[model samples]
Target: MTQTHPTFAEKLIAWQKQHGRHNLAWQVSDPYQIWLSEIMLQQTQVVTVSEYFPRFIEKFPTVQDLANAEQDEVLALWQGLGYYSRARNLHFAAQQICHDFGGVFPENRESLQQLKGVGRSTAAAIAAFAFGKRETILDGNVKRILCRIFALDGEGKAFENQLWDFAEILLPENSSEMSAYTQGLMDLGATVCQRKPNCAICPMADICQAKQQDRIAELPRKKSVKVQEMTLYWLILRDKNRIFLQKRPQKGIWAGLYCVPCFENGADFHNYLRDKQMDFDDLHECATISHRLTHRVLEIIPYECDCKNAAFSANFNENDGIWVDLTDLPQYGLPKPLQQYLA
Candidate 1:
């Protein structure tokens, strides 16, 4: 009888057991932590996510706790992490789990996918890590690993479907191996099989088509890149020691985050001040702030205006906005650029 070589899942599991990240802050059976980590990890590097995970977990601790917290609190913790929508959805999903599922994260992938911000890949991750369910994940890291392993071409929908099929096929048979196997693929893609892979130590290097074909760099075809630029004006209105901040509407860029009064242009700011008959002095133009997002570049021009009357109040309550003392700036959830401006 001839001895058989171990399969892909076997090699990956072995590698994971020996070298993969085993003690991440969120690596546990607690669905709340898993859900938070998965949401945070999307489009974010693990190192960055690691820093935020502990602080968030320390604050929330449980799904019910997260659900009960105010949105502002959640966003405050998620301040520097871009993509504010993810934080919003995480809060919404926690409430949904509490209201709909009795505060317990659903065990199955199908049910998990129904929650806000919990898409196919994230659902699969929660299932595998939290519930020990056998599911295949096709996140960016996994996609890169699989594409290199098979030397896949094109980023079309059909190619994506093929990758999913491969992911499912490669899943291990034993349910207990699901966590290790899933994490193995993630670890490999993130560490060993990255864009510039360290093929020497990659357990799958021998079987990776891209490595064998001398096309590791080209296997995962690049997407077309386009960047758009936008411009806006902001007013840093100050009354003595307090700065006025407004909560943005909850459906667009930087939604729900605190920001200074913004307008289409400096002319709009001037017109608003004139119309309100608000007395101000020491009005001076500040430096232009350039902020870069995934696909958009924002050119923000700020006008610093000091109210002449120390007794005058914007009088905007919490429902509209607030006059935050500069000393208490850290208590509010602000967009990165705004935070930088204040800092």
Candidate 2:
């Protein structure tokens, strides 16, 4: 009888057992921790999430605790995470788990998808990692790995179904090994099969179709992004020890977040100040900063206008915003770009 060679899952599992990340802060079997890590890891790197995860868990130790916490507190904790909506959705999902599932995360993929921010891939990850469920996860990293290994064709969402099929085929048979197999794909992609993949050290190097064909960089193609540029005028109004910030409408960019009062251009800003009869002791242009989002780039120009009196004029209403203590600015859930500017 002829001896059979190891399958892709077996090779990946072997590689993971030897080289995968096993000691991360959220490498536990707890569903809550797994869910948190999955959400945090979305559009974020492990190194960045590692810093915020421990602090967030310390505050909300349990799903019940997270459900009971305020949105401001949640956003404050997730201040620098970039995607503020993730924090909001996580809070909403925690409430849902508490009220709908009795504070226990659903062990099945179907029920997990009902939660806010929990997509098909994330639900699969939580189910597999926390409950040892035999579900396939096709996140960005795993997608890259599978695409390169099989040399998948098409671009963007066009190849999603094919990728999912590959994911299912690569899933380990034993449910007990689900966690290892799932994490293996993640680790292999993140550490070895990255954009500039170190194909030499990759466990799948021997079999990767992209590597074999020298098309690793071109296998997992993406949709072209056209970044739109917009200019913004920020009035950095300060009085004594407080800085005036406006609460953005709860719908657009930086929704429900605090920011400096913004205008489209310098003319609009000056007009608004003139109409409000607002005067400053010293007003001058500060350094300009450029912030790039997924599809939009903002050219932010700030005008530092110092006010002698800490009190706002009678024309300023409650809807405008509040004057926060300069010392306590970091505690607010400001946008990452704004936070960096302030810092």
Lowest summed-lDDT stretch of 10 residues in model 1? Answer: 1-10
Residues 29-125, candidate 1: write the lDDT tens digits: 8888888999999989889998999999899988888999999999999999899999999999999999999877789999999999999999999
The parts of candidate 2 lying over 4 Å away from their true place are 1-6, 156-158, 265-271, 279-282, 310-317
Candidate 1: Cα lDDT at 278: 53
Candidate 1: clashing pairs of residues? none
